[model samples]
Target: MKTSSRLEKAIKKLYVAFHANELNPECCKHCAVGNILNNTDSWKHLSNDHGSLELNYVGKVHQTLGRKFNGYSPLELLQIEATFLKACGYQLPLHHKNKKPKSSADKEALFNGLTAVMEYLCKLDNINNIMDYSKLFEFENEKPKYQLPY
Candidate 1:
């Protein structure tokens, strides 16, 4: 199935953020993107088997976005990765940190990339505003509290 152009653009923007090492948030255990990037097993397999990290990331993104938008095929994911990587001028194995943006350009790229991801997420959830994506994060963070049997 063909994804929308807007979704494609969002993916490209996210790839740029990933390439720039600007997407790692504090406590990757709570961040979808961070989990994919820091997966040692996946990286090891990728190195040994010549596997595609891009596909791995896309699969994680698809799962995180939920079953409502789980129609992407491996070929479509590869195409998205190819388009993004082709415009990148760096090598793989991106190194990320939690430091602030070093410059205006860095800040701009980060903002654009984050907005793109949020936009795509909102579309998936049928939300009207990008900011609404934050609610999803909040919901995820709020696991059901356990209590002693009354």
Candidate 2:
């Protein structure tokens, strides 16, 4: 199925953010942006299997975007993410693993890249005024829910 123009625009913005070095993969490992970039290398290789990873990433995006844009269910978000991945020549696998060592720089890159895409999405959905995406840069006094136990 063809993706909506809004989703397409969001995907394109993600690519632009990545190439512009706006994402930080390491810091955003658990974020939608970080997950997509880290899992698929910015969608460069079609062979990289995402499996449930796609759902996980898109779900994360939905958690934030959903608050702003109503009517989109989690399943719908998953479908959108899957469509986006397929358009980029990637597929969602049932299972997979990352054998390579984790790279902080790569993580940071993805995180930053996703942030830009998300910001654009918020603006597109008219949620920018409600939630300041820039707050992502601020260090919260409380630990983030996604913070690693280790």
Candidate 3:
């Protein structure tokens, strides 16, 4: 599937961050949107609260002005961060009293989070989920229902 240049770059950056153990849903500079924006914490200013999809005044102005950070709008960035945090076992609008993962470095949790983020990214690009494996289960009359084009 052909992906937009922005989507391609975002996926490559996220892949490296995931493998390098740099992805952290709680850190402004290491979250999904952060990594997609080159690990900068600037995106955090888009929202008054971390993991919030609602844009603040500054964010609203940017959104109205058609500003995009790394090909994503302020609201889109917030949504991406929220998606990552939720999949990483964090409750919405993260707070000190909110439920969280037992360990910060849980590989399974991180993998799940990344998978979810990747799916969301693909969805934003209007493409098939690259991580989908459901086709492997497709069968007809004891034969594979689908064949790999490659």
Candidate 4:
């Protein structure tokens, strides 16, 4: 399946970050959206509060102008972060007192979060979820219907 260059680049970066143990939910520059934006915290300025979908004044202007940061709108970036944080068991707004997992660096939890974020990214691009494996279940007879790409 062909994906946009921007999407391809973003996915590759995220995959590398995940395997490198660089994906973090607590740090703004290491979160899902942060990684998508080249590990920068500038996207945080899009919203007044972390994990907020509501865009602030700066975000509003950017959205109004149809600006896209690394192929995603400011609102989309916020949504991505929120989705990632939620999947990682973080309470919204990302406050210290908010409910959170015992270990923020839990690999299993981080993997789950990355999977969710990747799926959401596909949705934003109006494409099939790359993480979906239902096609691998197809079978005409006893043999496998599809071969896994290597």
TM-score top scorer = 4
Model 1 Cα lDDT, one tens digit per residue, 6-100? 45555554565556664533222212233233322222221211113443554555446653222433333333222222222212232343223
48-138: candidate 3 lDDT, tens digit per residue? 8888888989999999999989999888888888988899999988787889999767889988888998899899999999899899889
Model 4: which residue pairs collide?
none
Candidate that beats the other on lDDT, 2 or 4, i.e. the better one: 4
Overall lDDT per candidate, in order of appearance: 0.38, 0.40, 0.88, 0.90
Question: TM-scores of all models?
Answer: 0.30, 0.28, 0.93, 0.94
Ranking by lDDT: 4, 3, 2, 1
Colliding pairs, model 3:
none
Let me know the TM-score candidate 1 reaches against the reference structure. 0.30
Clashes of each: 0, 19, 0, 0
Error of 2 at 95 (Å): 18
How do the residues 17-55 of candidate 2 rate in per-residue lDDT, one tens digit apiece?
Answer: 456654332222222333333433332122233323333
Model 4 Cα lDDT, one tens digit per residue, 19-127: 9999989888998988988899999999998888899999999999999998888888899999999999989988888999998889989988988988998887789
Candidate closest to the true structure, highest lDDT: 4
Candidate 3, poorest ten consecutive residues by summed lDDT: 103-112
